[model samples]
Every structure is written in structure tokens, then in C-alpha cells.
Target: MRFVDEIYRLYKGHFNGDEEDIVAIIVGILEEQSHQDLLKLVAEMDEEELFHMLATYMVEVMKRKVAMDDERPPATLTH
Candidate 1:
């Protein structure tokens, strides 16, 4: 939960929509996992390991977004 809050605080200004909405989306995805699974994963990871995992995930997401942007056609100006 604290990690989710940190994510919201870090990204809220950079992303579209309300901070609460962003937090909700993150938490909602997390809620889809079984509690036992989540606990098992959490128990296996230390704080630093979790941070690195999230950082790696963020980098991958950014790479995909950049690739998508590169594939998009340029906008045309209309008079």
C-alpha cells in the first residue's frame, strides 16, 4: 500500500487525470491477485529488490511507448 501511494505521488503530476484515479487503477490491478500469492511474493522480496523490479517494469513500459510513438504518423496542420 505504501509503495502504491509512492507511485501515485511520483506519477500523479506527470500523468493525466486525478491522483486518486491513478492510485485506484494501480491498486485495482494489484487487487486482482490472490492475497496468498501477493503475500508470498512480498515475503520473498526485500524493499530494494521490489524497487528494482518496479524500475525495470517502468523502463519496459516506457520503451514500448517510445516504440509506439515512433510508429505513429506525424500530425498535419490545417488552415
Candidate 2:
């Protein structure tokens, strides 16, 4: 399965409300795997797998501003 598809399968109901969330979820799904393991996994990926990884990380960030309307500001941003 593609990394993107696997992410959807494993985290099917974990909320896909935001593109940024999708990016984070993809990372979360692959989080903490060994670096060598990741390299090995990535090395075997074909163009599509590569897109699954690359496109997943392709998110909209810092567009206009880093904050969202009605979204609570993080503690770091509060004071």
C-alpha cells in the first residue's frame, strides 16, 4: 500500500479535517521509526510511494499568518 493509503487505513477515523492535519497525521503514523528503517523503507518506494511521502508533507503553512481564526493561541503565543 502507498504510505498515503496506509495512513488513511490506519488512521481512517482520526479526523481528516485539515490538510495540515493530514500532514501531521502522516508524520505521526511514521513517527519514531528508526532512521535506518526509514531510509530502507523510503529507498524501496517507487514514484508513487515517493509522491505519497512528498505530497503528504506538502501542506499550506504560514500562508498570510500562522494563526487560524477562532483557533486558540498556544501558550507560547499567549505570553
Which model scores highest in TM-score? 1
> Model 2: per-residue lDDT, tens digit, 33-55?
77987888788789887886676
Q: lDDT of all the models against the reference?
A: 0.79, 0.70
Deviating ranges (above 4 Å) for candidate 2: 47-79
Ten contiguous residues with the weakest lDDT in model 2: 58-67
| CA lDDT, candidate 2, residue 16 | 57
- Tell me the number of clashing residue pairs for each predicted model: 0, 0
| Cα shift from native, residue 52, model 1 (Å) | 0.6
Model 2's number of clashes is 0
RMSD of 2: 8.0
In angstroms, how far off is 63's CA in candidate 1?
0.3
User: What's model 2's TM-score?
Assistant: 0.48
